[model samples]
Target: MKKLVVTLALSLLGATAFAQPLSPEAKTRTLETLQQAIARRAFVPGVDFSKLPDALEKRRAELDKAEDMRAFSNTVNQVLRDFGISHIRLFTPAAAQQRRTGQAIGFGLGMAPAPDGLAVSTLAPGSHAAGVGLAIGDVITEVEGKPAGNNPTSVDQDGRETSLITVKRKADGAQKHVMLLRKPYSTIRKPTLTWPAPGVARFTLPSFTNGYSQPEVDALFAEVAKAKAKALIVDLRNNGGGLVNNSAHLLSLLLPPGTPTGCSVTRQMVAEYKEKTGKESSDPIEVAKWKGPDRKTTLRKLPPYQGKVVVLINRGSASASEIVSSVLREERKSLVIGQPSAGAVLTSIFAPLPTGFEVQLPLSDYITPKGVRLEKNPIKPDVEVANALPAKEEASDPCVLAALKALTK
Candidate 1:
């Protein structure tokens, strides 16, 4: 409980790992200093500076013996996950950043850039590019004939690619010929919201590609009220997650005050949170781990949106996006429709590095207070719906149909 309340500090850098070569001694010194900071909240002063060289001998046991990058990554990730702090992360140095200063682009599937440009990194095979002619590393060069790059003046130091780019597949090479521009991607889908039914609000979350925080949540609740909504149908068809806590916050909106949405468990004990006000509503036995004024708990004065809510989700709903669907069903009686959500609930913590970047590591396991783990297994819809049965399902989704039936009844 002393550890679970650790909140992630603002990300000082992105989750891209840097590639720095460190001697064994340097590694041990760095690890010891970092651990001391975590333990004491300050650095140990006046220590023997030369001892770091000796520590490298131990470091060689791990690095020198590591079979490959994959094995090393797995070992590091598992070790990080053991730490209950959701904010702790580690990024190894990599060649991805140093080798390419230009933005890597991809034109695959029907997926194109939005108002925000697409920084293509990886390409899925079964995309529009495969059929219309594109390669794996191909960067989109143009969209309906526009140079879509946003290459701005280098940030005084690095020639980071800041452009709306479309890379065409080179006639012979694996890399796509790229075109840079200043205009927004023409194919990018801005949210076009509409109410599909009197009680159903159909807004394309296009993707959970953006971080949804408290303010975004406030805006969502406000929208529901503005629409005079009694029941909400969140369309998470293609949405991927942005922030895990944001999703937890979304669950908080639906949940009554004092209900435990999720818990983070650490090394030796169950993690605890404090509201600075309310107490956990669960049984007394389950409440003992909670302590301290600074203890982590729910946010004070949860927004009072107790009206019936329905979440329409699919595989694209992942990470924090799944938090809503999972918590609603687990914490409240809210109906879930559409399809199963992507079962990736663990939060990614990005730890800052010497360079202006951070390493993203899966730091901790997330679960509902009731103790339901949602890692490999996603939350099953109260009712399952398949894409094949379009007409008879009436709502084009079995889950939606079931939710509507539940709400109206």
Candidate 2:
């Protein structure tokens, strides 16, 4: 059985190394290594790793025909899908580099699923997409002359290359064409804080990873307190999860003392506990220690805003994002607005395969303070505000508007 909940503390740590294509012998070794790692480290229990060799043997014929890294990885990924769990994804060499550096060459645009096509869900102010008149709720109709939705997340623009993007504006059913230039991923939009209203402070957290440091958060909250903000709206839409510790620290500023955010269980600690005690104990004292004493509690006292704390989330919110949102809503009494979250709350670890690609597998399970497992059950918002595209101004974002309305009432 898979572990039902992710822990309160998550590492979300991944490692990568360089390697060339694998030889026939190396391919077999890599498969065996991956199988062993999954059996030993994955949070999914009741999987007999001893039978892994036979499983590999049966797939060897197909795997042996893979001459390149992509082919091999695709084969392994298909096999892993049998586990029927999220967070078990493989990255090719190029993808591994992109993941490690968080770099990609494309126009700064964040996309999400739309009814007709990939919609422009996120457009950083002054970004290429924004400068070209791309607005939220615009359905991308074509990319590079091909129909959109082929590669919604990526545009293979070579150095300084330009790609033509066509979108249909939801406002008046008008078609618009825009040229997007390829740029470094670092040039993407970053988190920003603003005073949308006299007493309302909104923090748009675009991502949870990258250089999103604690000091940055400290400075933001300091400003919030200085402004005497009466209402705080944490907009976490499209913020995929990053480090669990970072989210925990963010919660520390808002949550009361002794609040239990959640708990984690790793395969390594489980094995160690069984080896030492000759038995497994649920919430083993030893495993608890690995999570550290500081991680178990929230002690920081934030400003006495005493005002409405509204969180804005959507399907793009996931992992650590979900963790922080759930804790604030469940324990801190904050109002959650917008759609449900992505429900990707598992803790994954990335390791290098023989082919130099990286594979991220769920290494730990987590549970919320209320014993809710966020594996597949996303956090439903108290106020379900659907997407209202083609807003004339940023302030008109449906989620933000909903938060402000909730705060005033």
Candidate 3:
């Protein structure tokens, strides 16, 4: 019975195993996981990721073969926004590109939650925002048609008290409309890989939601194999983490055979144990754990890379990303770099409820191979690097530079 709980607990820990492309059907199922969890009160404040994308897919096939993918994806964006979860998001290739270059539409204004309205923290001078005389202190009361408070976590520019923001310009104030954005900037998606340092070999696995998760990861490994790279670098910089099976395959790629990636409880075990005494244990019962330890590779029977590795992390690197980084740091002769990671490395699994939905919950806690747990207190980098975000434009990245320096030694 203990085994079952243990297994259930490990389900979340194993999410960093691998990344695979999600089929339309699989995508739908994944979102269902969130909805069901909300229904069962497993993952609170959860919203369904299934509805938007599925609807768009159908619209493309029927409504307009000439449909603009960008527009369709925008719809998906708005839908995700409705959920109001900080981590609940969707990113696409076009959006990703736009974000990187910062060139789409607005004069350059970024929003944060203020006491009452949205905060205009980042402003690109001489852009549309500045041209129209929108000052940083100006509060944003509304965006399009929705209430800003749909996401209760928003603030205005003046730092005043406001919610359900629907701010209109003075001219439009009596018109019941707010002309918040005179110049609209383009939106972009997130980066798939975070290259820590120039000389380091490994890369961070930020999320499996990227369509190329499986293929790109395989290619990365293959590249490492071909290069015969010795010093590796994996940077889970601000990665929120995603999915279960993908995490498993990711770990499988690097771990020695039978390394016990994680343990979890599944239905079959639940049924078997329940049958034994017709009673279900309330507490977590240990179940089967993933044991993928040492093994020989097909290529010249070579062993997995046992060379030095350094993982770069921060408070944002949560869930599965933390697990992989922590495991390698614990078992191998590796170094952790940067500030402390998010430290969410417990085993979590998504439970599929009967109502076509699933709920993801943490099952059990895992100690490092050395038996040290990485929960609230994340792994501290052996050599801490100062926090640099939106990455400052220098000749190169300092974190990568640090990794290179470490590897050279």
Candidate 4:
């Protein structure tokens, strides 16, 4: 089965901790592996990579100047940015391991860029951040007396250091300082089910990545089936996608058996396609006919959900989340509410590099059953609503309110 690492937030804090500067030999090896992978696996049609070798050579000076893995990754990413695509990125070994295991060696906090500084978007329960009384929506103004720019943990030392963090509370503008010790913690937030209203069941699926529990998902689906809710609200906001199999399973539960969700077009498929048609075609309908893996056929062992469906998404909803939302919207006549989804959908896999470095490269292009290419084409919600920081409690979230209101109508 094809796995997708679609989460923009997958590379979290402590990515630089324990990182060592790459030796001259290691840098050369990394560059070689990266170049070869792109040439062999990358499947963005019409994107010219003829200059990639020249570009990497041109950046050799910068790569040599990289003092740490993060710096090295940034230099490599700068070259990759030329591709103008998503799902292709370099990760430090620390970050790569965190992405796969959902564990990080830092104060467990999910942050996003705020006008003032990085804001606490998510705080894992029992984490050092949570234990220190950090709350969501709190803007981190400073870290260790330095102005907290984007990354608050840029100074962290592999879970062995403590730093004073200045935070402006969301409830009030009051600022406070707290010393937080970095430690290991789980970053996985499991899928949760709740009844928002009479006959309305809401499932907040945070992620579909590896390390996400399959039994948990099965149990949640069972609950939804047992609830017999007339309307089901699937909250996929901020869910960066994971395994394609997980997505197929989720679709199987909501969609009819044998329904076509989508298919992946690999480099081999592209080659054969162009050979047969005498030219390359970017149209999804044409690509769907090529021999490749179909998502819908990999259904999990579960009964199809028989209920009115509504999906909630935001800019962070991507990959498998985008696929699920799009398929529901198209096949089940489900109402998709909220902001536009993250247009980073593609099938990618992670490959290890020398010296504890890794790269995620897209090997296939994804097209929905309806011929819509979701790579750069974000899913526009039927009922567009501006996204906001969710309320401290899910019961009072504006997005959920909007979804419930729509369901009632």
Candidate 5:
């Protein structure tokens, strides 16, 4: 089977990807395909399959009124929200293409909600935003002469059109206007390693998504070994997760071989479990114990890291990141610091639709080795420290300071 994916980030298509409105027949076909896929494949716990038909029917008129692919996708997503679960999404053809290619058209600015406006949290290397003097901690106050909302993409432009953006600089509180054009840029954020204190190594994994070089990871681990670091801090504050294999590989570096990390409960496994146990409750422990191949185990070839470890997480850490944090806490007794992790863990896959769109549906539910269901149950940190605001420098980051204190103590 292909590696399972767990991510909340959705790739959106450029303005040029929008096409004419869907025909009546095409809309009907797309809705039916989406409904069928949900009924057959969605296995997230507490999902009501019976309500799906009515929900789609109720929204049929809205879908019919959609002017283009973007509008159609927006309405379809409303139907999907009825499940009240994560990982259920509709990707436009252009977005699907971007996902496959790992490229997106944008100014390459990562934004966060700020009191004044959207704060620039990160700038993609060599991106248009970075090239145009857009720096981290800059607050975007206006976009196209309109107030910049909380969303990061408020400054985004359609196609190659230039968007006029006004930003408040963090250094001097000076507002500056710049024109940004949307162009294809790589979406990959490579992992970084740094030493925050003596004998303490901080490894920041921006994401576990595809395109990360394994050799680069190996080199980082080599650096850790070379420094003879006594304490390792794995920073996954904004990691939304990616391939399951990537998480497993990272876990193997810190855990023993054949260690049971967790289990993925699928629809078939749930059915078989019900048949044998004769129980109706969809509890995690019962479902996870079903005799199947959904169990996750670590495989560390070299000796595991023999040092104190700390996992830093926040509201954005999700899916595979949650899995890794849970394992490190339970098995290795690692210290977890920062805010609670994002309670969005599920194994999902993208399937193409008749209208050239892709539907992402959860195929399995995840449960920790101790029977803790992580879907809605977030992993609370041992030391709950709020992350510093985007405008703050790294030296003022409370989470890192907390980790360093614990390590040094």
Candidate 6:
């Protein structure tokens, strides 16, 4: 009888082993570190940082009063809203780690703004979502048992970080719940290339930073060159952007040598200029010399794709994605299709917090060659498709079909 009881107890213990929650100490540490990091690293270009002390102190008080990690996250996000800018955000621990290390959390699913709510638009093949019958047209109504309407993505209290998603499907108005393990999605790990139509090559560029290296970017273009594609379609529809250098590398393959990509204004450089010159000039031309030049010594040797290029963008396309699209539209003469981008073009650093979460604090602002700030003002597509999401089937993508027809014309 003692042996039987012992075995049952062991089983129970094993079952509950993955259910650890963050302790109060961990919560406190996380809040304190987040406060410090934001104060030290967060910058709003053209706004004085000294004027933010009162707000920061109030946010700190709110953090102290928070009862749990979710409350703490809510308070921190509320404070971030004061900046009134994009790109600065506090990511969940799982998401923070993903951005920091290029890992992914939850099933390989991508969401887009739908009329009803955020809809699942893309799914990684053979992914957990796919295995569990999660399909496109399913709107995510709740995540982790909360109404997910603009709610920050979160993990369960259990240590597994598994995401419990409540989905409402549009096909038959059916609702279902799914459990997805936190793992890297394969879409952004490599380029998705296909020939959607004759002589038109389509490459889905999910992210500039995720898993793809410089050699891989070169290899991608080399394959494009081999296809002898007369027209190219680059997909940035759901991409949330990535490394700036990688975007530049991709743009270099389409642009002529010595093309001016854009310019950036960092908080440190601004502070130094004020300290040294004691003058604050908001004029971009006054600081145009600081604009980084795209000097390519070998781009001339590579046969640039001298074809009509079309870029697809949506509300999820942001940061480095915006930069590339804006420059390509103005410089390389690429036609943009789809809705406006997310306009999160600022340069930011992902500073990890004590509780394993990370804060993306923007330290610089990027200005396009035409003197446009890519913060709240996104790059509008030449052919503006309505925000309505397409059906799950590939043939249903109106943007892709439109691009093909445009290329043929």
Leading candidate by lDDT: 4
lDDT at 255 for candidate 1? Answer: 65
Q: Tens-digit lDDT track for model 1 on 344-384?
A: 65554434334322344344455665556566566676656
TM-score of each: 0.50, 0.78, 0.49, 0.88, 0.88, 0.79
Query: Residue 357 deviation, candidate 5, in Å?
Result: 1.2
- What TM-score should be assigned to candidate 6? 0.79
Clashes of each: 33, 10, 70, 0, 0, 0
Per-residue lDDT of candidate 6, residues 265-342 (tens digit):
776666666677787765543453454432231363466678889988887778877887888888878889888887
In model 3, the runs with Cα more than 4 Å from the true position are 1-152, 155-199, 265-303, 346-360, 363-367, 388-395
Model 5 gets an lDDT of 0.76
Better of 1 and 2 by TM-score: 2
lDDT of each: 0.44, 0.67, 0.46, 0.76, 0.76, 0.66
Across residues 250-288, which tens digit of lDDT does each residue of candidate 2 receive? 777676667777766566766776787687655523454
Model 4: per-residue Cα lDDT over 1-409, one tens digit each: 2354443223243333554667788888888878887777666655666678998889889989987777788889989887888888888888877877777777777777778888886777668888888887798888779888886444353334677879999878999998877787887777888888988888888888744577888888888878777888898877778777677778878877789887777667777788987877865457676643376644567788888889998776888899999989888899988888878887877777656677887777788877788888899998887544555677777788888888778
Best by TM-score: 4
Q: On residues 226-261, what C-alpha lDDT tens digit does candidate 3 reach at each position?
A: 676666777666555554456556666666755654
Give the clash count for model 5: 0
Ranking by lDDT: 4, 5, 2, 6, 3, 1
**Candidate with better TM-score, 2 vs 6:** 6
Query: Between candidates 3 and 4, which one is better according to lDDT?
Result: 4
Worst 10 residues of 1 by lDDT: 152-161
Q: Assess candidate 2 and give its TM-score to the true structure.
A: 0.78
Order the candidate numbers by TM-score, best to worst. Answer: 4, 5, 6, 2, 1, 3
Worst 10 residues of 4 by lDDT: 7-16
Candidate 5 residues 94-196, lDDT tens each? 7777776667766676777788788876666666788898776688999888999897656653233578888998779999999887666776678988887
Off by over 4 Å in 4: 1-16, 143-163, 282-286, 289-293, 297-301
